[model samples]
Target: MTSAAPTTHIVFPLYPGVTHLDFCGPHQVFARLPGVHLSVASEGGRDIEAEGLVFAGLEDLATITHCNVLCVPGGFGCVEAMERPGFMAAIRRLAGSADYVTSVCTGSLILAAAGLLEGRHAACHWAWRHMLTEFAAIPDEGRVVNDGNIWTGGGVTAGIDFALALVARIAGVGVAQTIQLALEYAPAPPFDSGRPDLAPETVVNGYREKLADVLRDREAAIRRVAAGRANRASQ
Candidate 1:
């Protein structure tokens, strides 16, 4: 099924520590859309490996002259991306010009840093929700949020929901519903620990422990990124 648009470039900004689900989920949904072009972009057309899977065919950020849609995937390396002048510049430039800009997980942080989240209600991984405040973003707890042209999704798997919602918004409810039905989007979690509100105390504690480790590492990287940004600003 071909889309009405001649071409829709869906850009994925790649970096280390990127969650495989973030890109894969959305890619699955977007690929089904007609006439949609997908590009996995990086600082340079360099090869990037996500969770041990090597991607050697990724394009450089500069190759995206214009985009209909931009999909930013989240990872541990967002701080590094935020600090890179060329990287941040590419995001700010391209995403600013994009008709629609969307992000998954902590990728929202990158968008926030690029000053694209102002006055937009966005969502991100609950573990990192507070960080959006640093960028003057109104954070929501939903799995996905669509605020004007900006679309944001919570952690990893939530990207599927976000992408499906975007499909419905752009293509129509019929298209989204069709895809959802084909993909068996019916989700029945074995346990009710998906969110803290529904999880048992022990399950929530375990999730917290896992998040604490990530927070520690993220905090250190964030400080370095902040310093780098400040340095660039001063220069």
Candidate 2:
């Protein structure tokens, strides 16, 4: 008889300003994996007001010393989340025992802030990927990047790609393919404005204009987080 599949503990770090889709899209794929114990953990186990709807609740991180996989989801709240005291330090500690440390979109920023991506390649939302230098992360241009045990996805929807790739690594190609098929993960968008280079110059410019304020604020936040980490390390 075959032995039971090893149970894998997967955790998604939660915050108030998350983008729910970034969390849920990859979650559906990860949850489908066999023998996977998926959980959402926050600094204080509080409910989050994400971009979409409200997240029900999450567990506190105090009891979790490690996990098989830890995925950090990104959204508008990441900047403020970085500012929270001991937040990045806690993530750094939890990541110490994580076999795979991953992120989706701006979630990579959080990982970088935690010092997980120092001198490592990572990807994030195009709008803010440039800010990775603040945390000493190499900005990767791919949809999903797997550098050593660190995996990062670009933008919001790219979480699906990251999840499938990780599933392939953890399980097998057959399992990943089956999950993809079950999810009917096909992309046939009506327009071709997915990336900045592919989109028309006018569209890119418009997006830049719309997000100008957010970009400025996010840049400052990243700098602040980096400085805070530096100061803590010195203490």
Candidate 2 — which residues are off by over 4 angstroms? 1-3
- Looking at model 2, the pairs that clash are none
The TM-scores of all predictions, comma-separated, are 0.90, 0.95
Top candidate by lDDT: 2
Q: 1-235, model 1: which lDDT tens digit per residue? A: 9656677778888877678788989989988887788888887888887888877778999877878788998987777778777888888888877989999999998898887887678898888877876666899999999898999999888999999999988888999888888888899988877777888989888878988987887776665664565566689
Worst 10-residue lDDT window for candidate 1 reads 222-231
Question: Which pairs clash in model 1?
Answer: 3-34
The numbered model that scores best in TM-score is: 2
Each prediction's whole-model lDDT (CA): 0.84, 0.90
- lDDT, candidate 2, 18-126, per-residue tens: 8987889899999999999988888778777886677775788666777999899998889887777667767788789999999999999999988899999999999
